[model samples]
Each structure stands twice: as structure tokens, then as C-alpha cells.
Target: MSVPQPDSDEVVEQCENCAVKTPHNVSIKLITESNKEENTAFSREPYRITECSQCGAKTRQRMNDA
Candidate 1:
């Protein structure tokens, strides 16, 4: 469930390993859970996964609906 982001949309985020702001490849994933009950509804949570282009360190961030 990896969502692709265009190069123009790339963001500068601090890398935990590098300890500095750097360009990162960002992807989005939708997490969902459902119950066995017929009428039960499922919830979808979107998260952003960022990987540092330089060090390849990855981080996950939960996204909030605006």
C-alpha cells in the first residue's frame, strides 16, 4: 500500500541517524482494520513513511485529516 510521491513534492525532514535536515523519499500507506460482524465498519488511518535519501534511515508518521 505504498503511495508514490513526485520528486517535486519531496520534503526536508531531520533524519534520526544523520541528525540533520535532508531530502527524504516520502510514501503514504493506509492502515485499516475490520471486524467479523456483518454491519461492522472499518477504519482507515493514513501514515507517512519517510526515508532519508542519504542514509536510508526510515521513519513513520501518522497523518491527520485536515
Candidate 2:
């Protein structure tokens, strides 16, 4: 099953481990490294989020760039 979106800014996705919908603060940050050969401007950072409060399920999300 797909995760549910309750509103903007925060995601109310369902946690399979907890068997409930948990609120998560979502954000996207660019990945960078020192002394690296890869490009700094176009690196993809995983859309990250906190664990579910009820069952402590680790969660991650994907974001789209505008």
C-alpha cells in the first residue's frame, strides 16, 4: 500500500510496523562531500523523515524538485 498524505508540510503516512498513521516532518537536503570528484550542485539527497512514534518504524520519502 502507498503512503497517505494528510496535508502540506507534514506527511501523515501509514507505518506498517505500527499499523497506524504517523506524522513525520519531511525535508530534502543536498548531499555533498569534501575532496570529492562528483558535482556539488546536482547531487541527490534522500528525502528524510523521523520514525513513527507508535512503533518506531524507520521511514523515508522521495521529493520532487521544481
Candidate 3:
């Protein structure tokens, strides 16, 4: 398996629980491919998820181009 993108480690926006901008763990996963293989270019985008350090809330964040 390939390693997650470097920037995926960054903390996403503010936390929903405590409303604090804290560092959180991040996980990345590739999206599943659809039957329409020809249109799979954009569908391959990975999900960048973040967990709130203060209250343990999880949120999905958009990834920036590397």
C-alpha cells in the first residue's frame, strides 16, 4: 500500500465539539472505482479526514493539490 500524502497530517479547520483549532490525527483513503472506468479521473480523490484533538470529533476535509 502507498503512504498517505504528506499534507494529510495537517489539522483541518476548527473542531465542532469545542470550537478550537487544534491538531488532530488524519487518515486518507482512496475512493472506490465506479463501473464507468472512463470517468474515474476525478473519482480517485482520497478522503482526508481529521479528528479533533480536544474533543475527538471527526471531520472530512478537502485535499489540496500537491
Candidate 4:
């Protein structure tokens, strides 16, 4: 059986205010990137911010593979 992969339609995270692992509003965008030839462009990854659907607390996260 194949493991179910996470799709763009899903939002998974823990809310500090609610103190539960619930679905949240995840916003992703490219913050900064490296232009050096040797450095991997993936190193300067995008920001995966999560917002609580309950209390609406925003949290910033560095997503390396996002």
C-alpha cells in the first residue's frame, strides 16, 4: 500500500493557543534566495507560515522542502 502524501489541499499543524494538532491556514512564499554558483538555491528556502484557525496566531517556519 502506498502512503498518502500531503497535498496542497491539506493543512496540518499544532496551534499553541488552542493546544491541539489541528488544521491551520498555511501560507507559503519565497522570502530570499541565493545567487551564488556553488550555493544551493534550495538552501534559501521559502517561508511556510501557519495561522491558527481558532485564535488566529501566526507562526513563521522555514520550510526546506516546501
Candidate 5:
């Protein structure tokens, strides 16, 4: 079976593997999680998935609301 690939945009960002700002594929994903307490509503958070084009290293970072 073939795996589905996520849609990403090319952007300039810091890459850990390259140790410098480089071109990377960035995708935004919304994560949903349930609260530990009972009868609580689930929380939705947005995160950015970054993949370095040069070294193929991947990283995830939470997106904060300003």
C-alpha cells in the first residue's frame, strides 16, 4: 500500500540538521486531545511540521496565537 503524503509549502526556516536557515517544507496540522478530567471538552491545537529540504530532518512546533 502506498502512503498518503501531506501537502506542504516551501519556506525558509531554521534547520537543526543544516545548522542554518534553509528551504523547508512546512505543513500545518490541527491536533485534538481530550482533557484528563472527566466530562471535559477536547482541546484543539495547531502545529507546524517542518521538514528540511537539504538534510531531510523533520521537526514539530506548536503554533501560538498572538
Candidate 6:
């Protein structure tokens, strides 16, 4: 139940085409399970939530490997 987020000092952005600016209040939730990780709830944890302001289309992508 560990959820990550952007810093409070960070600013929210919107789609460039919309021309309308608003907070990225939208959320993208994701969880993945694999046979190899038998007992785990999710093998692939979502890293980031990307959202579109105008149409509200969203996507979740894995974070970069360190």
C-alpha cells in the first residue's frame, strides 16, 4: 500500500494543445501480476501517472531503472 507522488513544491501541467491550464488532479492506478512472482500482489508497480487536461486521457508508465 505504498503510493508515491510528486513533491508539494512541484507544479502541475496540462496538455499543450488544450491551451487551458489546470492542475493534474487526474489519477492513474495500475497493478501487474506475474507467474514468476507467485505470492506477490503485483510484480510490476506503476511508477507515474500522466494525464491529459482537455480530454482526460491517462496513462501509467514504469519508472526509469536506476
**Cand. 2 Cα-lDDT:** 0.58
Please write out the lDDT profile of model 2 over residues 1-66, one tens digit for every residue.
Answer: 444444556667667776777765556655443345677555655566556544557766555535
TM per candidate: 0.63, 0.46, 0.48, 0.53, 0.63, 0.41
Kindly list the per-residue Cα lDDT of model 3 for residues 1-20, writing each as its tens digit: 22223245665455677655
lDDT on C-alpha atoms for all candidate structures: 0.73, 0.58, 0.64, 0.68, 0.73, 0.52
lDDT of 4 by residue, 1-66 (tens): 222333566476767877776667788977656666676655567788887655678888777753
Q: Model 5, range 13-63, lDDT digits (tens) per residue? A: 767777777778888987765556663345767888888777789998889
Stretches off by above 4 angstroms in model 1 are: 1-7, 33-41, 64-66
What lDDT is reached at residue 47 by model 5?
Answer: 88
Cα error, residue 30 of model 3, in Å, equals 1.1
- Candidate 6 has what TM-score? 0.41
Model 2 steric clash pairs: none
In angstroms, how far off is 15's CA in candidate 2? 1.6
- Give the clashing pairs for model 5: none
Q: State the lDDT of candidate 1 residue by residue for 4-47, as single tens digits.
A: 34367678776788877777889898766445556334566788
Candidate 6 has an lDDT of 0.52
Q: Between the candidate structures 2 and 5, which one is better when assessed by TM-score?
A: 5
Q: What's the CA RMSD for each of the models?
A: 7.4, 6.3, 9.4, 9.0, 7.6, 9.3
The Cα RMSD in angstroms, rounded to one decimal, for candidate 3 relative to the true structure is 9.4
Q: Which structure is stronger by TM-score: 1 or 3?
A: 1
